[model samples]
Target chain A: MDLPRLEAILSRYEGESWDLIPVLQDIQDAYSYLPKDELQVVSERLNVPMTQIYSVATFFKMFSLLPKGKHQIKVCLGTTCHLRGGGRVVESLSHRLGVEVGYTTKDMQFSLETVGCLGSCAQAPVMMVDDKYFGRSTVDKVPKILKLYK
Target chain B: MVWKISDETAYDTLGEEVHLTINGVTIRAPQDQSLLVTARQNGFEIPTLCYHRDLPSEGHCRLCVVEIGEHPRTQIVNSCTYPTQAGLVVQTHSETVLQARRMVLELLLARTPKAKLIQEMAAAHGVYESRFKTDDPEELCILCGLCVRTCREVVGVSAISMKGRTPDKQVATPFMEKSSACIGCGSCAFVCPNNVIPYTEKEGIRTIWGRDFELQPCNVCGNYIAPKYQLEHWAKITGDPVENFFVCKDCR
Candidate 1:
């Protein structure tokens, strides 16, 4: 978030096009979303176009431009999950958080999103809070999951 | 290097040519060109939706798939982006090819059921309709990325780009805000196969992506012509005075 901290991240890499993704990843690690001003600095320093950077950033699901909450909650909406009541899971999460997918709660505690697939079809109706995966999730279990997170 | 004696006329060009077979018919094709273009030129009737000769290939549609090489080693690839090489054997209408093409068409039909082009293609492939349920029945854009490629590669402007991922992906301006970078060329609309992009010109103003730009009136014919930014872009590119383009192309 600070200029000196951002510069320290920038100092580790040689200014090159190949370093763009890693640099952006580090920036996201330091600050939850990619900053416009820092992206411009990467563009100037790495001799890449800002548009190209923005294109790469938006193309991948791993990157986010908007600020994120402290805890990231991802609900799977793949074919397997969807057929197994994934939509209900999303509805439950939305009702609990008072925020839709791709939105962070007012308290900045949780950000919710839906992913196409989690490569874990065996665990249908799955949701991930931070790094832990919870399978066969139901509306009744939403409050208990948040309790453990807070 | 050996060619059929009867079809020597096909390889009359001076450049080094590669001999390849499509649908059991041997043909001479120039190296490094896309297989889809060369195959179509050779009368193979390969179908494509996202491919425009002027734009770079993104191969998002998966409609132009063709089987390459002899079985048990054949591979299916999107012919629009696949490069032609010497001694390459391709089958445009093999069973595997048809099945792959049919699946692509059916999936596309599921995404945009009302698209007339997709419907016709489905009928041609004997796919009446998709078995899968569509998330959006009115969806027209198949996310082939032709408009995005044309805007960035040909127009030299990154005003629009693809956002999100499959099934939920869409073409949008940066931040979904009014773009400061768009030149209002309408090339994106021109290249879109489905005509999904809603761009219109009326009353000396061009409307694209929910934004309007003033169109310059021709000095001689009094017709509202190109967008102001387009003329300025041309001037910047060719080092010509902006005044030189005051008259429209037809008037000049």
Candidate 2:
């Protein structure tokens, strides 16, 4: 949404070919998502290809094409989490959020994603909102956690 | 190089020649030339999908594998990227080579079950139906990446890319939407072996990547010249005036 901010971010990078990832990260940090227009400008400014930019943007799990929510909710679907009913937690979250796993809410409150592992197997069926983890999370406990984020 | 100039060969200009055998036929060729080109020059038919003479070789298709070395120590290598070495023994049609090619074809057949090129190739190899699973029966892209390579290496732009990973992977523009970066040269369409890239020319306008690019017409005969967008890009690249591209071959 802020076009001038993109120039500032672009100016920060050394314009080296390898700086593409960091440049994208900084842009995503400034804007909630990688705006298509900004990405096109980045391609032109850096003299890279849209195909390459898009490839990098989509390849990484951190980048989102659409505007991500203020809070990112990552549900762990690792083996331990799955056995402990990670699927049910995902279903509950999806039902509560009214959006699919890889989408943002209409209100831009939260965007949901399922990660393979969060490295907190001891806290199985874990869901993380930004950096805060909710361990041993159940369907009933999901609404309370959602309320805390809201 | 160019070995023959006028009436004689230039030995001094030639690279070092290396001796190799293909199916027991001894042959001498320039060292480090791709084994695929060397084999083809010696009249061997090695089936490949991703090789283009003008484009850089990237052995993406894995369809050109040939068995190297003798029995008990044989190895399969993609002949397109495999350079010719001295004393190198290659089997372009050994039973192992056929089996490797057959497996490659079978996997390609399963991936793009509807691609006619793969269908014909499969039939030639006596593979009627794939034993593997066909996730999308209508899928035609075998991910050979010829179009992707041609666009970057030749056209000199990334208007499209091989996006995603595995079954979800595809060649697409940014965000899979109409890209403004595309010059509509149709180079991607031209290089696509599967011929699945949909584009059409009507009147004098060329439509590709969901955008219309105006084609310049020659002044003399009124035939369609290259796309004005493409000509501009080429003008910038080659440093010739944009007007120079307006002249058709016949007029030139």
Candidate 3:
């Protein structure tokens, strides 16, 4: 949001167009989400088009356009996890939080989402609340997990 | 135009050929030709779905994979993008190659069982049924990305894109909203392998991917001209007036 800070981020990339993805990742990391104005600045600095940058940003699941909440919730719906009641975990979290996947709560307390896999198939039906992994998660455990984050 | 053959040796040096074997048959082809092209030229019929001679190969379909060598072990690679080199031993229809191709076709069939192209390919490969469940019966777009590549590389306008991670990946606009950048060129529809992208023209109205454009009618006859957005795109690029394109090509 600040011009000086934006300029500092832009200067980190040495005007190399191939560094566009990493530049976007760094910008998202600094601001928690990609801002439109910063993306415009990136387009101009890298001599790339806005549509091209937007394509890459929207293509990857890692990037987010909207400001994320303080705590992130990722439910694994992988083949193993889904067969082990991972869908129920997502539905339970959605019902508890009153916000669907990819949306943050109105109070900015939590953001709910789903991922392909976390590579922890041993811990089937896993849900990650921020950095902590909740293995063998259930609908009854949703409230307890939220309480720990808050 | 008639003055040619100045030197026979000069002509021979200008054009060099690469020799390769496909399915135990020897063939001579021009240097740098893709394996698919060389195979096709020599009468070896390899099934392919996502490859087009005009566009760059993305190799997403994995149907044109062929066994590359016999030393140590053979490796399967997409023949559409693989270049031809001298003395390369390639088998277009080995048992391992057939098994891999059948598996790819089965996966494609599971995703888009209703697609006639997929059904035909599946039947040809003897993959009569898919072990995987079909998420959507009417689903199309095998995620081959031919349409996306043609739009970006040929049309030069990336109105649509492929998004999300694997197993949940889909081709759509950013956020799946109507893209303001789409010019309704129908190049995506033209290049689609399974006719996935919905396109229809009725009563001088054209709709593609849920965006409607009023078709420009020819001034000479009643037949419809190109979509207004397509002509507008051409006008914007060439600095021509929209009125100039009202006349149909037949009249022009």
Best by TM-score: 2
Model 1 superposed RMSD (Cα): 6.0
lDDT of 3 at B119: 91
TM-score of chain A of each: 0.94, 0.93, 0.93
Recovered fraction of real interface contacts per model: 0.33, 0.88, 0.38
Interface DockQ of each model: 0.37, 0.65, 0.35
Model 2, range B1-252, lDDT digits (tens) per residue? 111221113345446899999999999988777888889888998998988776667898888999999888999999999888999999999998898888989999999998999999989998888899989988888888888877777777668897876768888988888877788899899888888898999988899988888999997888998888888998988799888888888998
Off by over 4 Å in 1: A1-7, A36-55, A73-102, A112-150, B1-15
- TM-score, candidate 3, chain B alone: 0.88
lDDT per residue as tens, model 3, B59-160: 888999999988568899999888888989999999999999999999999999988989998998899899988988889879888888777767766777
Q: Rank the candidates by lDDT, best first.
A: 2, 1, 3
How good is the docking of model 3, as DockQ? Answer: 0.35
lDDT over C-alpha atoms for residue B215 of model 2: 92
Which pairs in model 1 have colliding backbones?
A: none
Tens-digit lDDT track for model 1 on B1-252? Answer: 112221223345324678989888889888867788789888888888887776667798888899999989999998988888988999998999899889989999999999999999899999997888898888999888888877777777778887766655788886666677798999989888789999988888899988899999999998887899999998988799999999988988
Task: Please state the error at residue B243 of candidate 3 in Å.
Answer: 4.2
If scored against the real structure, what TM-score would every candidate get? Answer: 0.81, 0.83, 0.79
Candidate lDDT (C-alpha), each: 0.85, 0.87, 0.83
| Pairs with backbone N, CA or C atoms under 3 Å apart (clashes), candidate 3 | none
Error of 1 at B185 (Å): 0.9
